[model samples]
Target: MESIYLPTSYRSSKNLETAGYFEKYSKMCPLTWGGSSSDNFCRILEEMALNDFSEVDLSALGASCSINKLQLPSEPDNFPIEVPARLSTKSKLDFYYPVTTEATQLNVIKCKEALEKKWIRSEFKFGSKRSLKLTITDNMSNHFRNDILPGTNFIYSILIYRPFSMSMGQKHSGEKLRFAMEIEALGTNLLSQIIDAIECVSNYGVLKEVENTKVNLKQFQNAKQEYPSQTVFIDGVFYNDTRSPDAEDYSEPVIKWAREKNIGKFTVSAMETTLLNTLTPRIGYPYVYIHQGNCEHILTFSDARLIQPNDCLVSEKYPRIVSVCRSTNVLCLICGIAPSQWLVKKCDRFPQEKVFLCTDCCNSYLYIDGKKVGDFELYPFFDEKVT
Candidate 1:
């Protein structure tokens, strides 16, 4: 991906207003009026005129949850031309704005109301088909400040991914793909909400779940093409499903094609549509598990969610159950910093609740009584490993 270029001199009204808020707050007088709909911090940063502005490449952010460019092995027939970038408007707060309008003024008023009532946080949705959904936030924002804060008051944003498209092809077109973007503001103080919207966007945005309901699977299964049972050589490998009990059943061409190329690096026995994680079960839907990869993962459809956390432990109460993070708004018990994901260790002392340790805190060996006890290990459900 090419670097994003923005004007070096043009300051967005949002930034100017934020600077004004800080200025007025020092004198104990607060600004209570907002004029424009907010954009995500990423998009805001992209537009600002800064001499030393830099954007973090999503692809280089590593497998830690991010708004990454979606890549597929090969194009399948049912690929979505326009994905519904749904913006979730729910947050952990007392007030609620279940319905939102396209009007920017209404949203600004709604944000102000939430602040006046002492609401700590709120999320609003904005977007349509093929466009990125913006998760506009309203929160009493007291978070980290990077280089942009000193020069410009900017709204923070993060990329959110939800399972909406089924990728089957390896090659990608040169055209730039538009990802779902979410925006948030953190109110600095009681006045920040009225003056400058300083709501913070969560770095750990929600990844979409694949839509794999049983009804959808049945429809897909019934709609698949039937092929005669015969031995076929694909890529110099003998591809034969004739001996299987379900050999006569119709197969989706993508799965058959994947099998030919050994797409997921294993035998494709059964394609079951199931939720990826037990915790985030219904957030997204219909994830296609290619069955046995080198291992048995309930939601191993793509590389993003496939990689197991290095120090994660299995649930003693429920085997074969995988959870991405123990809690949604969890603070590292050892570090105090909020992480996108956590390395969860089962609490033998209290089996009901688990302990969350951030990667940095875990690396430092959070100590007690002269003993290092934060090292964690994975409880593998299967033996095979994939590169």
Candidate 2:
């Protein structure tokens, strides 16, 4: 693939020397042509004439010669010096080749093309190809300044990954790109807006406290309102989502506990207090995003650029999802084919502590004629599928 050149301020010169500097000497010097031994005298004068001597008499060196008829020295057998061939050895630390900005961009383009081709050939189509639409609310529009126009604002590309472990201090292991989105309203948009745009499968997960109870998948339709607790940890401060009346401040308790333990001094604030552009977050640095109470995700700022005219003009589509991870459904342990809907725990029938089961398997294996078989806790299991 052809490498795309990035916009650069530096321009390379066509010639190293200044115009007419070396050409003047080349024409005047007799050494440039194969002249007699007496012409060596002129070479000495030519060198002096070339030097920065303003007081020197340049007319005394005689007129320049026409070298068209002058025969140059015959080529010597060892005229040009030859360099010893060195073995091309790389250091052990040099795992990857040093790539220029253009090369890096070309590699990225090729990878994207390959991924697109794979997506086209794959069986799963709908969820993997779909984009998340960000509806612009009236409140969001009200905050937009009249001075800041559509294309002038700074844009940010955020890459979010699924947290491998629930531990806050532990580094996220493995490579799993959950969401790749672009947001244009950096100055006007609040951190709360960005938090609201983030969607996770755990938000729709079912929770059951009682044992020997049937799990209802339909109950998740209104589960979002029941679990509105979310918090974003950026820099050293925690930004809590306090939009909903029932929304719990997950940061306050953590901040208080941290203060008590003398781990580190941290502050908690509402997500609406800070603007996206104001935060000086380092690109590729991992940040914590907790939503639906305990479901955590690692968020990182991938790239940032000024909004251009080619970008989407619609103000409603500012926070647009450009790329998404392919949907991967968790299969039932018993059936091994159907997607799991229920998570059964503490049952003697199952060997493991917890096992995923489809609705049909859960109904048949766990229950007998509409009555619970044993003391097993049942909860609805939401797969990692984005749809």
Model 2 residue 185 lDDT?
Answer: 43
Give model 2's clash tally. Answer: 0
Error of 1 at 155 (Å): 34
> Could you give candidate 1's per-residue lDDT for residues 40-84 as a string of tens digits?
434444555432443354334434442222334463535333322
Q: 299, model 2: CA deviation in Å? A: 0.9
lDDT of each: 0.28, 0.60
Per-residue alpha-carbon lDDT of model 2 for 53-142, expressed as tens digits?
A: 333334433323422223346533343333224523322221122454545434333444444444444425555433343333322454
RMSD, every candidate, angstroms: 27.3, 18.8
TM-score per candidate: 0.19, 0.58
